[model samples]
Target: MLDYHFQLTRPSLDTIAGILAALFVIYSVSWIIYTRFFHPLARYPGPFWASVSRFWMVSQIRGAHADKTQRELHAHLGSIVRIAPNEVAISDPDAIKTIYGINSGFTKTDFYTPWRPAWCRYPDAFTNLDEPLHASRRRITNSLYSMSSIARAEESIDKCTAVLLEKMASFAEAKRTFDMAGWAQMYAFDVVGQLFFSHMFGCLAAGHDHRGYIRSLDLLLPILCAASVMPTYIRSLFLIGGALVQPRVMKALTSLKDIDEAAEQCIAERHAQLEQGKSGDEKDILASLFAVMREKGEKVDFGRTEVKVEVYVALFAGSDTTAAAVSSVLYHLMKSPAVYKKLTNEIDEATRAGSLSSPIQYKEAAALPYLDACIKEGMRLHPSVGLTLPRHVPAGGCQIAGAWFPEGTRVGVNAAVVHRNRDIFGNDADNFNPDRWFGPDAARMDRYMFQFGGGSRTCIGKNISLCEMYKMIPELLRAYHIELVHPEHEWTTHNYWFNKPSNVETRVTARATGT
Candidate 1:
């Protein structure tokens, strides 16, 4: 009674709809069953939803902080938790070596592909896909990020800090609540500008985001974060280009284009200045980049693109991350008055003893044990990067937490997860207690500190951030007695990827004496 002619191809609308719906259900059920019961990672403990689908992971990210979610997941599921069907978050501090260690054969996942531009076919230092090529890129200009080289620009750092202090003093005089979060961002961006171009970005001087760079990045970051979860660069690019955000709006925002254009303009200007026999700070990043270009360009394959990537990475890394970190130190200090007093007391003692200098030399700040402890503790509680540092397994399988992971598996350790591990950081790790850094575990804790990441891919601009934080935190605390405007409320932070703290309203008053 059934007409089994090729009616399936030309089915009625209702029949077609019914068939499609049925097929979708069948596919969905099949995928869930396979992913949960037969996938290589099926044995790992995680949320029931996560075991069956990646949408669960994406939904959690859409809903809350990935860092906190990951930490809670690890706590519930033990050392390893399947964050997604294809990804696992390892909380074991010891696993850092296996995952991110040099020569570990665990290369970067596709998460970093968006950082590279299409024209620049070669991978720069920060791109995660090509380790060997990027490693070579790192070698060419590693000296530019060296402590000594960054120290050469100490005068520039001092100038930026002085300007920043002047702004703080104005806020103290006005008795106006300081937007410490915004100011920290300005100072960081201005510092990077001075370091690269022999001039500041006018952000600190303007007392707001100059040229809309900060706002643009802030607006686009969520879209970028969402795109990051995509499986490939093309897919992520499509999402950024218009899949998630409107094309016109994305075009209006200057995330990569602004940085690239700035790099191009700066390089062109520098080259013209060079042609005219004008010289810049030899220790400045641009000068060092040029030096490497002339000295080892062919050997290391350094060129205009490499220079741009370096400048791009420096500005991108230095500004937002350093800003967030500086804010963290300030936020925690305001929240925990005891820690604040102890740190300021140390600075006061050192100042009275003439051990501290104006601008607070990096060495001087490094010498203050309590100050150091406070910085370490703040970063531990809130690392800048919230996502797990995902790495792809190589040809041979590797062991982690006593389990063998097959090649090409995605694995990473979230800084928050490891930083708060009770076994490693002790039971009080969840609290902002700086005293944890004073004992025997201090060295071990330092080894596990993923605030700036680990292994060969550790943040190269770390000295810049360290120098800024080490110098500025003590300077601000000693010069101005700061308290939270809303002492009862914690600063607002959204951990889409970067746990950038904002809503930091602090009242500042100038102290009578540094001593």
Candidate 2:
């Protein structure tokens, strides 16, 4: 009787497993057929697998070349490609002004929903999907991050730059080949730290991740990238597993929790310092945030929670993205010897003439035309963030890139695709020739930069990155002769969300006169 009961239950379990597998297969097949043939986006060009399921897009993103792959698809499929069952990636630069323009009526899609931290009262500017809220948040302290406002805090950037140069100077003296990309990111974090709390993280001084900031980014970006490709339920499953296992790990790994706690500490410390008259009158970004809240009153929705969330967002977004940009620029400069020489010559000339400050100034850097072209070319070649900003089409359907996109269709423009458009940037768009910005159609081409995005909803913290890049690059070039460790090979990069380059190992030699 016992043997008979065991046999009966085993078969019953096997039967149930078999039934579930068969049902899943049947459902998958039906879903694929419907999505590929009956879906509205079915008529559009895309990978058949992509049309069948979002898993195709997820796999592509996880494999870490979605940007390059999408670019190739657009090149083959023309300006538009159905990147998901409900989403289309439009490559034409003309799609920029139409989709992202002020009052274009295209609202940010759920793709950005995951970017907001769970602890925040309202989403920070980068992830805020609510139009009114985003606009209000931007209005509250947008001026504080403006190029003019950032330039006023030039000493903070200069301090960060000085620390970075000193580190590079050590590498030069020791004649050691170090990972410039890692150092660049470290320096960027320090810059944000200095700008935000009136003190650097001492990452450059210590020569490391410095409180596991970069490690948290390494962990966080992939999750955010996956969230873009997969369903929220699937993402929840991932987070659930991580939530269970991560906390139980032997070693204490840096997570978003660490960053949040640190941000809160920063808020308290800044408040104490302000109250004690310890903080100088220069007004760091945090100080400015407080000033806005006090002066504007409760009519403005900016509060302590909002300030903390902004701190976390700005620290990660400002540092990670800016680091990517700086790394890419430096890598491209290393790759293109002639262009690199030309830019350095311009900076050196300016420096020797006593026109440029020791660490360079944003205004002075802006005056260098070749340097300007190089920066633009670097960004165009490799946008810092290798992801599309998905926006939902409004009611009554609209046209884009000569194709009609129906209402509720998710549409976006990827810089990786749009920047390489042969029609706009010319036929040699894929190449790293800075002369494109100097061409007769330069003004027209300038409109398509799209790195900081376009129109009213553009990145509010963009000036912070530009402030650092414009000042730091010229100063670094003036200070050292940076040579790539592997000049013949392209620097290896991976795009989780930010298209960060990690293979930039370089040897720095101090420039006598400039130093």
Candidate 3:
């Protein structure tokens, strides 16, 4: 009886062990097969490890060394690189147009959904992917940014520009070293507040840095990288669940709440005034938006959630990015004295010739040849958005740089790579040469200097930003000359959808231009 029982149990145990072994072998074989042949990206040419791994992509951002990686990849791969199995990085100008141009059948990738705050009323403002929805939102905001509106808004512009000039003059008079980068932030925040919310954050008045309502929002580069590691559904989990629960994420939402609450209050005040027939020609983006909505006979009450989000999006977008571009241009100018001196002269000459006093006109500032050169050169060398905001190919797939790619392939144009392309800008592409802005030379700027991106999705706020910078830079320089107190100063950078400055430190002392 003992021998019979032992035989029955032994066979059953042997059968179970064999089944487990076979399952393990199947999984191993399937993984190898996927990496070797079944993967859609298996046919693309790239680094062997990169084709099969997500580590390289995440590591670049994780190490805060994306610039180094991009430079290396471009150096090794020429104009086109298959950075991942499904994505290609194109550095050529023609390819940029081919991939990002209005006709290019590419749309914003699903990667942006998670970066959006949960409380966003008009979540569709910046996060929407469908082309028609984007168009509709653009229509609502377009009038506020029109040349006529900006011209009409010149009183506010003058007030803010004057405030900045006065502050710089004080620093120049005192001969004290101050934080120029910090001041730029203050100026930008204040200006954006005045224009968008009909209020001022008073960052400039405070002198020192003030953590305003918008300070908590980090651009979510880490999340973008994590999402890139796997399929779209898996990426959604990281953004929807993982990111929203993080402390930093919560802080950002809180900041947004502050801005929204304040904006809603201000909107209420403006609407009340309008209802009372108190028409004294109020100034601000909110005032104009309210006016437009009223004229259209749309009365759904002011301070609606969507209205608040729209206001926040415009304020946040206008302030930070423009400030960054302006600050970078200033930093580069300080580093290159020849460029600085040249730009100063251009600003002086243009302002003098025009005799502009109250509000610096964009039309006049746009004519400053050297100033234009300096701005273009600065944006090219250090783009605000370092990574190409990834775009998805249409359903039928598309051709980029003469290569046929499958549908839904993630494609992007790396500004860092394209801006430094030797083929278009010549060998000194990396240098800050403002001379490139003059004559037919400026007109010859390659299509690839997509600092603001390209096609219909290009920045809608370009005119407003350029107008502000065009005025602000000249006015600030007119009041005081700036020098970098720490000549060897360096700032940290993070690789988000935006190329965020990390702990950016600088001292701004005033100097005369030896006029």
Q: What is the C-alpha lDDT of each candidate?
A: 0.81, 0.84, 0.68
lDDT value for candidate 3?
A: 0.68
lDDT of 1 by residue, 336-402 (tens): 9888888888999999899999878888899999999999998988898888988987887789988
- TM-scores, in order shown? 0.93, 0.94, 0.84
Off by more than 4 A, model 2? 1-23, 245-254, 275-282
For residues 293-353, could you state the per-residue lDDT of candidate 3 as single tens digits?
6565254332345565566566556666776778778888888888888777776676566
Give the poorly placed runs of model 3, Cα more than 4 Å off: 1-38, 43-50, 53-56, 117-125, 208-211, 219-246, 249-253, 256-280, 297-303, 351-359, 439-441, 502-514
Q: After superposing candidate 1, which stretches have Cα over 4 Å from the reference? A: 1-20, 233-254, 280-282
Top-down lDDT ranking: 2, 1, 3
Highest lDDT, which number?
2
Superposed on all Cα atoms, the candidates' RMSDs to the truth, in angstroms, are 3.1, 2.5, 4.5
**How far off is residue 147 in model 2, in Å?**
1.1
